[model samples]
Target: MRPGAIVIASSLLVCGAIIGCERDDMWEQPKTAVLGTNEFFDNDQGARMPVKGTVARGADNLQEDDLLYRGMENGKLAERFPFEITENDLNAGHDKYDAFCSPCHAKSGDGMGMIVQRGYKQPFSFHIDRLRNATPGYFYSVLIRGLRPTQLPGVKFEPDDDKVHPAVAHKLSPVERWQIIAYIRALQLSQNATIEDVPMEQRGELDKPKTEGSNGESH
Candidate 1:
């Protein structure tokens, strides 16, 4: 046989062996078809049942804490916060309030936001005695379910009226809602605080004139 012919035949055999191995791999590759029978385990399900009590990632727990998740302590609304508010938490709450609540409720929580100025319905001021004294759970309910005005147009709301109508909906997360509520409390304190409410050290700071750049003002 010619040297070239032998070389060609050897190359063909090598190519054929490579193709055969690939074919074998294709046939023998391990993967179970969906719902197909498998004898590897007893009860033979190709799709194995998840291990008992295995929770999927990011899945909400079925047994959620009422105070933490729903802001309820008993059958009624909770008066206290679900978690303790730290200074950092307050700052986060302030940021969230500015981003979401300020457009409608205003940065001062006075219900006179830019939106209200633009003819949108003015919501109740957060500093109102009714609201300032409201339970945390009441605020949580309003944040989650939201308030809708049920009274007739131009009808003024009395202090004793049921103003928190939980009909409108908002999409804030529970934590974010709680944070905004904390900021609202802070705003209420800042707005209505008496001279006695301020610490002597802080009182002096308050009396000091606010200069340019005192509150992010341009120099």
Candidate 2:
């Protein structure tokens, strides 16, 4: 072959190999993308523990607030809430609570949730004297740190179980954990609510009782 032709052919072969290395999806390419199996590390999976000093993406706001994320101040339970409880925060908390807590703690935090009716062990009522007096950090700690094994007696719990909230609760962001704590406090107060606790404009509504018909319908 001519020298010029040989050089051109060799260049083409090299380019083809280089392009094939990137385009050969059938060979050595991960079945999944970033979340797929990764052979580069000892773990053959993409999901691995973060390295030292690895902070969660976009977690700077939460990470910096020790009380918010850790539910502690100087290694002790915070005496008060880490942030102000606005109406918006309370509303968001209601949704989170209903989705995660009501199944076990009930809408009223009375611990008589549907799952409990279906044979799951009953948890302590949030309105209990001890919990009513408990600090806000106490509930937040439960979500982040989980219940003590001794405190979980009578319940057969597995972290993998969907019915249980502890594992799922930990997955919640720091703000979300605190929101739930606020909602629980609100739920506790609701049980012992007095007419005076109702707004003055709404107080008249409390004076009237609903009349029930023979068919168990409210008239």
Candidate 3:
């Protein structure tokens, strides 16, 4: 009676241990992730709501450079560019302006661009009296907050119902907007600059008399 009862008790104890070792479903169960929803949280949201002063990464830092990003200071259009202009900036500006602005404003800023030639609306010329008097921030504002067809007060705009005209900065960065402005300012100066506007070293060349070249060309 003692040996048989002892063996039966040992077998029952081994079976109980095996039952306790069975896997839990939690390892494979689906659960809500961050920013998701679940019934477990008091508010039924997975992630905790951001605190009152919280901001997106780097946004606060960008806010500090509002002159560069918003193109404004003291609620006015910035009087100057955020950084000093460089030759490299001009080159970048030329490329970006040609790639973006030249389609509607033309390489000459004359408003008769290829797009206009192809039946798009004619934009106001950069050389126009009002535009010529505009500041760098004015052009920056244009890129950031596109010129709506409605914004053109005296100009007749025939809108294309098939097209969606988003603001220029919808795809452009703040830096690119600045670069485009640089190219536009260059274009404006080219049309209105005087002889004194020439660089000191280049000014002397303007006074030199022209000579007849061998092939009826003026040099």
Q: Of the candidates shown, which would achieve the greatest TM-score relative to the real structure?
A: 2
Please write out the lDDT profile of model 2 over residues 3-66, one tens digit for every residue.
Answer: 9999999999999998877756677665557678777778687778778987679663446677
In candidate 1, what are the lDDT values of residues 1-219, reduced to their tens digit?
999999999999999998776554677567777898777979888888778979766432343677766667887788898788988878888888887777878888888889879977778888888788888887776665555445333234575655443422245666777777787888889999899998887777876787766683121
Error of model 1, residue 16, in angstroms: 40
Displacement of residue 137 (Cα, Å) in model 3 is: 1.5
lDDT of 2 at 91: 83
Report the backbone clash tally of model 1: 0
Better of 1 and 3 by TM-score: 1
Backbone clashes for every candidate come to 0, 0, 0
Score every model by TM-score.
Answer: 0.62, 0.64, 0.58
Over 1-219, each residue of candidate 3 has an lDDT whose tens digit, in order, gives 799998999999999988887565865366776677887868898777667888667552457787898787787777688788887888888888788888878888998888889998777778977777776776776677666657635434456623223477766777778877887888898988898899888998877776556442111
Best by lDDT: 2
Please give the TM-score that candidate 3 achieves against the real structure.
Answer: 0.58
Find the 10 residues in a row with the least total lDDT in model 1: 148-157
Query: After superposing candidate 2, which stretches have Cα over 4 Å from the reference?
Result: 1-31, 34-44, 49-64, 149-169, 207-219
Q: After superposition, how far is residue 119 of candidate 3 from its true place, in Å?
A: 1.4
Ranking by lDDT: 2, 3, 1
- Give the winner by lDDT: 1 or 2: 2
